[model samples]
Target: MAKYVAPAISLSPFTCPACGAYAQQIWAHAIYVQPHANTNYDVAPLRRCKCASCQAYSFWSKETEAQIFPRAVASPMPHPDLPENCAAVYLEARNVVGDSSKAAAALLRLCVQHLLVHLGGKGKNLDDDIAKLVKEGLAVQVKDALDICRVVGNNAVHPGEINLDDDPAMAGQLFELINFIVRETIERQKRLAEMVDRLPQGARDAIAKRDAKALNGLA
Candidate 1:
């Protein structure tokens, strides 16, 4: 799936959030009037656009410049290498971010929890699972990223600790973190292993012997 890229201006070409296609947008003002004392007063300025590729429409307030239709905020595409289940939930969270950031955050937290299990973490408490992975040598940056999602997600579920609605941007960050974790923990390792597998058998055997001797020496 194509990653979402917000348009610099409403009329500018951009990746369609609905269709994930980069295309030009045709823009027009949507006028609405209210009758008061026999005089019609225009309401807030509204703008609408149609994607050239998908022909899908998006509406936004000219004053606020916020998307009103398809309430979901633009979210980065899920990493191409994410596991199927994790990717599904990630997209689910993305679809609802504008409607309820808290709900989206909660869903992302679940995605992280599932991802940990897929990464061989014990399917237990989220906090414990994260700690276990950190103990097992997860990169410091990845551990910090995981904790950000874990903490925000907990706050979203329990409420009162942090107001997600007040800070939708933080929820957006979680999506990026999810992809980052996958790239670091899963994609990077897979690429390295594939590269190692491509080495000549004789070289691979020699490397294995070298590691074995190092381990024996450590013993």
Candidate 2:
């Protein structure tokens, strides 16, 4: 049995798994310290927190000085390179991967869709969407990799298609592919923007002039 405890003086803000919102005003509605006869660090409290943004509740447990462990949201933080829509769907897929592989795969497919849209790709389906990326200057290898993910997700969601088993290894592979795409696409743009920001004003103006001339076919 565990004993209830008053929450510590300072409660740090954490992201909520339910709504994918960063919540600062998390109130510990209930907290219980687990019974531990061995270690001093076993003083970690189990807590239920309510998010102000979405008004959704989440659970937290297992604290370390270096790391804060909240329920499903802890293992993998949403990628900074992912767009908001893709990140939300990616997190949803992660949350349910253990219970339903098919559902998770469907959510992952949506993530791919969001990514494609972010890249200004168009298609009637995911395959065409991937092909559009290739036409728009994405590397062939990356497009091929994304195609495989799309195939798996498509099979998982189809009515008569064979169901994908809840395989952790397979899920991990899909996530790895998604992470790579995000880095290659969004992160590259971020780096370029940062580099542009650091350029000298004269160099920036010169580039702008060159671009304008090219646009006007006067270069």
The C-alpha RMSD in Å for every predicted model, in order, reads: 6.3, 9.4
Looking at candidate 2, the ten consecutive residues that score lowest on lDDT are 1-10
Query: How accurate locally, in lDDT, is each candidate?
Result: 0.84, 0.66
Model 2 agreement with the true structure over 58-171: per-residue lDDT tens digits: 555535322233434232445677888888889888888767777777888888887888887762477777777787788876787688678778877785344577353565
Model 1, poorest ten-residue lDDT window? 35-44
* Candidate 2 clashes between residue pairs 3 or more apart in a chain or in different chains: none
Residue 206 miss distance in model 1 (angstroms): 1.8
Top candidate on lDDT is: 1
Candidate 2, superposed: residue stretches over 4 Å from native: 1-75, 159-163, 166-168
TM-score of 2: 0.63
Candidate 1 residue pairs in backbone clash: none
Q: How many backbone clashes does candidate 1 have?
A: 0
